[model samples]
Target chain A: MLDQKAHKPHERLAAHLKDDLSQVDEMIRARMASEHAPRIPEVTAHLVDAGGKRLRPMLTLASARLCGYEGGHHIHLATAVEFIHTATLLHDDVVDESGQRRGRPTANLLWDNKSSVLVGDYLFARSFQLMTEADSLRVLQVLSNASATITEGEVLQLTAAQDLGTTEDTYFKVVRGKTAALFAAATEVGGILAGVSEDRIKALHDYGDALGIAFQVVDDLLDFWGGDATGKNIGDDFRERKLTLPIIKAIARGDDEERAFWKRTLEKNDQRDGDLERALEIMTAHGALDDTRAAALDWAARAKACLDALPEDPIRDMLSDIADYVVARLN
Target chain B: MLDQKAHKPHERLAAHLKDDLSQVDEMIRARMASEHAPRIPEVTAHLVDAGGKRLRPMLTLASARLCGYEGGHHIHLATAVEFIHTATLLHDDVVDESGQRRGRPTANLLWDNKSSVLVGDYLFARSFQLMTEADSLRVLQVLSNASATITEGEVLQLTAAQDLGTTEDTYFKVVRGKTAALFAAATEVGGILAGVSEDRIKALHDYGDALGIAFQVVDDLLDFWGGDATGKNIGDDFRERKLTLPIIKAIARGDDEERAFWKRTLEKNDQRDGDLERALEIMTAHGALDDTRAAALDWAARAKACLDALPEDPIRDMLSDIADYVVARLN
Candidate 1:
């Protein structure tokens, strides 16, 4: 029953933003087309058509409207947010050597890494093009800074992937870069385009940042014990040796033998039979899963608190509910 | 002797822009550094320090200065141009699976494809960030559009690389996308920053466009017949199955036997020991090499003619001489 509730808020939010969401969708379709390079549209279509929730762009639109943005540039900014998100997904799949994303074959898997990488670059350039069309220098600065942060987060992730010495602070920095930066930008730009007060803009950014962290934390926790509703095989992160929050927490408290097990399984990438079960057991022994869930819930609560700066409206209520729903999966 | 003279004009232009070029270099060095991700500078420094001519950025500087504009923002725009160029080279090396660039092991070969793709992305984002710092909406539009065109050009080049039906017109389209788009943007933005007349802006764009076409055509010609002074082995393009202007021309005029040869060597990517030599023989037989050289000269002439819109000045004289030097490699 709780799991069923998790899907309701985003759907309702999408419906609330239906007209603007549709505009964003149309903008995405029009912008993704390539007049000369057919492969760009083909590769982009495969991912765009894959049933992503379009949650990020929806957040941008909702934030803009919540702050009383009347102009049409919100659509452009929303579409730009989606493009940045999609471009990162394309490159992330290649970097991870992933085969499936959103329960479909990845762009890199279907076409090639070269196409995925180049097309990702194209979408990023297109995102810049879209952002400029918004006619706001401040918006450009925020999004460009977010883009740099995202890339820095990715490079940090690559270097920090299998190392056992990765600290919790470093983990948060990586998450902030890879996941939360764009979310913050997505919402912050919405407030910016509306010419909202600086305090309100900061509040929107904090909301998106906390929501993104909570989302990623829950996603990581689900990787170990989450059911199929997460659309990922349990323990996938363990198998890949990614040092997520739970694993890092577990390793910090792990005994010598447990550390050796982690080194063998993750650092060395020599995963064996029963490794997944052992990882789960060790994580449980250290209470890592519960702590990670608690952390996600705390972030979700923080995200909800940031909405107090905004005027009461249906869109604002939806954002608050979306935060609650992000951590509800932990139940 | 002529080839040696070809290298002198660029050096002279660099000298002319020494103060601005030094500032641009400092900006590049500063922007490329990353506090979180150390690997970014490592990969970027490998290419940035590889002694590239910095011709694109120089055009930006020269155009602005020649238009009698005095502003500090030209350095930012010029640096942005170089960042765009470097980012493309990094991704291009990955897409081409090149082991060497600028006579050293490429970033992809030295590190891995993952680093190359991600860092290329970092630079693109950095370029966007740099463009925004210049304080001009029109500058943002020109550079963003150029960024999109550059990526599209790369994607077009990917799809069109080995196909035999790639015509002269298609080759120009691909070249324009891959090479001229940025060049045109670089010079166009310079004029815009100077707030020059519309005619001068168009002239700057046309000059960059024709100069880039001439540069690429001559580079393609040199790929087939260049001596060691060009720092490449002749026939490398043929060995790689690239359909440059000469190969496209030869394919267009070839008889049935020659068409079959192209089909086997290019489309099929099947090559024997004598294939490069034989390919050269066929191109000669069809006079494709001569025609390609003539085309390069014509573009160079067009590039020179565009400069008539600018005032008579030393910078204009240097630009005209650079065009002549581009095609001098054919001699």
Candidate 2:
């Protein structure tokens, strides 16, 4: 895994897809600008320039290229993907009451919550406009469904955030809604834009879905085990009383006394000193972290397998490698 | 204008379009449901069942009906319009930190800000899904642009909320962005769905724009002069330091002393005992209320004029009458 870190799968993909990625970036910059509302560009520029991995849009581009798409609509779809991602990030920060994103202050923190909420909405609409310009009904259907699923996932998470009774089924549903849906759509739209076969489209969808799930699982795992490099505070999810996969797994195996601890810290949000440490100890004792890591690896493997249906190309290989990279960080 | 109140233009329109409107309502109910997220239906039903006038969606139905649209997609478009309107209300209540809507507890207050924000986003995405299902590229373009305009208007209003420097031009821009953008789109999409002439589409767009502007102006006026029936507390905008049409008019004609008062009350958010009453006094002295009322009536007249391009029909007549009805309450 340490050796894998030096490979930088995303960097390799970005290098191979540099032209399309640059066009996507340019489209993003141009579309985010508003003639009447100057604040929109300002707010959007802050988040857009914050040095994110741009993985979702890159996935769209890579999938398009792999499907032998020579047309220009892929760039619009890629840009729309990025816009959707950025818009969700803006609203997610507000909903999560977050202060930082990608090692910088959040839009909600820099601007007001009102600005974050409204601008997120503006971006969502702008994304729709971009996709419409692509003139693909199938692409529009995929992206719109993804948007709805993403919001539904977030809302489901709201209801399930701190409930100790949340099941693995609900967790997967939430993950699919919040993370996998957009990823799935991002890739599926790429195949649709390429006018690829239905089988290839479904393969791309499955790849993105599994990759996103692995990505989110690793993210939740990092909340307990990763460092400041993640741009999120270690254990922030625990403090916020979010019942992500790690805790949800731990709660399943806990005894009555341990269950009460979760009830106090998560459901009731009544925390004391050393609660995070105690919770980590409980998860370690129950092998929840190890199980969660295993689950991520399984998803990553599934993601890589989905890429097998696509044609053999450098971009396809890189897409496969990125799935490995998503889970590799956990190792 | 006073005589127009007796006609009950909206009720007549509703009665005429009852079948379509009911179908739209049914579609809305069907689309708002989430299998995994029951909270979505619960929160949406609260606002949807609040006895709102259904004015925006009714406009879509009426416009489509008047244009001889025999297709069924109008139900989808109309529902999309209502979902957009309701989603905005959910987020607006959160942005305004309001406690009540339609004489009941707001979604934010009843559930939470998180629910309100997330559910609003869900509804927004759902609306897009509904419009996409309607299968009109033109409809998608109009609605997406309108969505962006709605958000941009809200963001601009956020930036301009309490500022004394907000001009009538800016007010109109904000009004168009927030309220009228959806209105314009609702009517334009109806015409587009009907496959009407471009000239007729423009007429519908203009009609909705003026009607929306008039509607908002009257609502703003009601915030000051109207009684309890408007479902908003009198001087709520004044207390919140909002720069609506009346305040913008008063500020334009205000003298230095009045300017100082505005700066202290609005910009600085420093209030003394009797600020709302004094603000009303200043607006009265400047004849700001009268001018504002005149502007609303002018927009209403302009709205009615745009309907002349459409063929003679009961729906078209009702639409024209509704334009008159929007500002008639001011009498």
Highest lDDT against the true fold, candidate: 1
What is the per-residue lDDT of model 2 for residues B187-206, given as tens digits with 9 covering 90 to 100?
Answer: 99999999999999999999
- Candidates, DockQ: 0.69, 0.66
- Whole-model lDDT, candidate 2? 0.89
Error of 2 at B303 (Å): 0.9
lDDT at B211, model 2: 94
Question: Across residues B1-331, which tens digit of lDDT does each residue of candidate 1 receive?
Answer: 1233345777778878889999999999999998899989998999999958999999999999999989899999999999999999888867777322333344345347778888998998998899899989889988888888888888888788789988888889889989999999999999999999999999999999999999999888998877575787999888777789999999989889999999999888889999999998999988999999999999999999999999888889889999998898777
State which docking tier applies to candidate 1. Answer: medium
Q: Work out the TM-score per prediction.
A: 0.96, 0.95
Q: Candidate 2, which segments miss by more than 4 Å at Cα?
A: A1-6, B1-7, B98-111
Write down the TM-score for model 1.
0.96
